[model samples]
Target: MSCNAASAAGPRIVSMNVCSDQLVLSLADPDQILGLSRCSRAAGQPGPAAKARTSPRLSGGAEDVLLLKPDLVVVSLFDKRATRDLLKAHGLSLVEFTVPRTLDEVKDQIRAMGDVLQHPQRAQADIARLDAAVAQVRAVASAHHYRVLPLERRGFVAGDSSLISSLLAATGLTNAAGELGLGAGGFASLEAIVQLRPDFILVSEAGNHAEDEGRAFLLHPALERFYPEGKRIVLPERLTVCGGVMLADALDRLTEELKRVTR
Candidate 1:
């Protein structure tokens, strides 16, 4: 399964989830990637998005995957159960992953994918890359203690147990969601958001304009009055939506944003 073989002897891989798509695109050799799920196109990070476009897009159905005849099919635990059973019935090898909720899981996943792909070098490289970001985040967190509420569409919060919260806590930001009885995450009313009174609310995008009802909830006048441009930290949804190699870059972006706001 080594990617080093001159004739590309590595496993032909089809990734079923956008998150696994990112990992596969990063760790697997180009020839090893047989297909990527359509989710990657709309929600994956820009880097993975670009690569995915050049590769074949797949439906969740077993038909397309059967055509590819991939040696290994990378999937998420969240993928459709029927699809997985169909693939298994055909004797296709499958590797499943769950969402990483902590830095430890993050590291474990990279290493695991590397082993699964038989590309140890690629996995180690990704881990090394993430470790540098981890160090930077830890350094910043150690310096200051700010409370940050990870606010999302419809005022839903990412609880303290989330991967992003772990990343935030490493940088010394307290998860304000906990104070509002959202340790495991739940929606908050506009009034509840204002009253909770955190130092900042981390969002997936910038602006206070409403594109739809969900967006409108976040753009409510009450939120804008308190958490304006300088107050709302915009971390792109691509990075935070999935826990993968993209998070290393996300961590760097957060460090810069934190520095700017703290100053």
Candidate 2:
């Protein structure tokens, strides 16, 4: 079936990816949303998760999405290729979004989503809020120079192209991964990390609790020995996973965490 442009108000929409789910819930009218991805309701998802409860959740299956008969389906580039291909074969109108690695890209995406949903004014308002929050953090961050490394599960470091790296730059902190010779992101050996000696290690969580083996790497004895307590910045996975309305909150949280560690 051929699809027409979205109506002035918007089209009936279903979001098949977790990140797309957040964007849809943030920008689309309640009446426009036909369904959201199941992961949108997962614990710790915050804003999107709360809103998702009011809508039906899909399991990212073409069959499930077909059942919704939505006028549009939004997805992430990383979403299952098979599912996306199936939807396209069935002549569904689909909008696919790439993962944003920088603040500018994030802003662009918010506006794009708004345009797709036929809510340009709402997108502008959201952009204004995001700009304001970023300015607030930038003002405080400009006064100090610190080196921060976004170390995630399994000793992987966020590269210069990652959102976390962009956030660090916006906050006036240097990304330590570059100093350690991993400009594009790669696993830093425990010994390499210890040598780099970043002023702070930005992690999704703190404390000794390791939810799994991947998490256990974050709590390794060497990491603790080098960057203990105040040196570890906890930004939470929810805020960093998606670039959407929650990004403002992520900036605020990062600014506070930076202040806490620097003090």
Give the per-residue lDDT of model 2 (tens digit) for 117-144. Answer: 9888888888888888778877777777
Candidate 2 local accuracy as lDDT? 0.85
lDDT of 1 by residue, 1-263 (tens): 44355235777889998889888888887888899887768743544666788888897789999998888898888999999999999999899999999877888998999888789888889888888887887777666678889999998998988998888876667889989998888899888999998988999888656889998887887898899878888888778767668889898998888777777
Name the candidate that leads on lDDT: 2
All candidates: TM-score? 0.92, 0.92
Candidate 1 lDDT: 0.84
Worst 10 residues of 2 by lDDT: 1-10
Model 2 segments beyond 4 Å from truth?
Answer: 1-8
